[model samples]
Target: MLYQIISFVLEVATSLFGGACLLRLYMQHQRVPFGNPVGRFVFALTDGLVLHLRRVVPSTGRWDMASLVGAYLLKLTQFGLLWLLAGGLAAVGWVPLLAVFGLVQMAISGLTGLLIVYAILSWTQAGSPLSAVIDRLCAPFLAPFRRILPLVGGIDLSPLVLLVVLQVAAMVLASLQQSMLR
Candidate 1:
């Protein structure tokens, strides 16, 4: 029970910090202004680690490599700590692989979350302050699906399609993780 609680807390912390780092990378890449509330929040949450990482992994204009590296390091730390906490690092070779897989899983989960919020805000508060931010964040992910899926009766189905794709990705990641155990 205590392990479960600790693991849950660790997961939440890593997810938010890692997710914010990734968001920082994406927003910078998209050239989205970081003056808004959403931008401020993500920066505040991620700056400590990202700034330190910036020394080693320099950003190249639109590409904020530091933020990306920071997020990956956070996932690596999370998986490493969890493995240690769970009693043993029996299979040391799997740590890096798990960390990489975890980072991919986190990215998928984060994008799914943004899409969910974007879809909800589109229905409830279409003109809200954060809606534009969410839309910009979600646009690239939704674009390819949008072109392929198109709208059904004026209702966009891309979000639904993206959600399904994310779910399938999650399942595949889980299977890969399980396979790594043996």
Candidate 2:
């Protein structure tokens, strides 16, 4: 019970901040302006760590290395703490490997969430700023699928397809993690 509670708290905290770092990285990659609410929220959550890490992790060609490293560090911390709590019985060396998998899983989950929000906003609030931001973010991910799938009866199905792909990726990730651990 105590372990569960601690794990839950750490997961929530890591997701909130680590996910923000990842979002910041993506937003920068997409050349999205940070003046909007989503950007502001991401900055608020991640600025401290990302800014400090920037000294050590330099950005290269549209990729914000600091933000990526920040997210990875958060995952490392989360897994490291959990490993300690788990009585250090398992393969301790796998903590870093698990952290990498967790970071990828988190990115997959975040994209999945953004797709859902994009769909919802498309249906109910098409022209809002938030909707526009989400649309821009989703566009790159959806473009290939949209090109191949096309619209059905004037409704986009790419997000559904992308969601399925992400699920499969998650499953693959889990299997890979297990294999690597073993």
Candidate 3:
């Protein structure tokens, strides 16, 4: 029970931090002003690790290497926590199979983040401050898709296509994780 609680807490922390890092990367790519409330919120959430990582991970070209590394490290920490929880389960004489579950959870979180970014952009188009903030925060991820997809008949379908691709990738990752557990 204690291990489960700890794992859950850690997982949430990892996801939030990772999501914030991704958002920062998105903002940097979009050239958005980062002094607003939403930007401040994201920065506050991730500043600790990001500040430390910035010294070690230099930016290359247009990419924020620190944010990418931060996200990956967050995921790895979540994985490690889940692995520890699995061990705890084994100590309790239960079948320890949480690693795959953790991977699935992480994948779902990532997919949800993508969807959220899409939704925010959509809402921004409809004129909302929060949406605008989110749009700026997610611009990096959407830009490539937008360029590849373009607009059709005055409607943009990049988000839809990207969502589909993200979902499919999530499914594949989940399947692979499950197979590894087995």
RMSD of each: 1.4, 1.1, 5.1
Better of 1 and 3 by lDDT: 1
Per-residue CA lDDT of candidate 2, range 42-71, in tens? 999999999999998999999999999999
- Whole-model Cα lDDT of every candidate shown, in order: 0.90, 0.95, 0.69
* Residue-wise C-alpha lDDT for candidate 1, range 52-128, written one tens digit per residue: 99888988878999998998888888878878888766776677888888889999999999999999999999998
TM-score of each: 0.94, 0.97, 0.68
Model 3: lDDT equals: 0.69
Residue pairs that clash (backbone atoms under 3 angstroms), model 3: none
Candidate 1: regions farther than 4 A off: none
Best by lDDT: 2
Order the numbered candidates by TM-score, best leading.
Answer: 2, 1, 3
Assess candidate 3 and give its TM-score to the true structure. 0.68
Q: After superposition, how far is residue 16 of candidate 2 from its true place, in Å?
A: 0.8
Tell me how candidate 2 scores on lDDT: 0.95
Candidate 3 — worst ten consecutive residues by lDDT sum?
A: 91-100
Error of 1 at 76 (Å): 1.5
Pairs that collide in candidate 2 are none
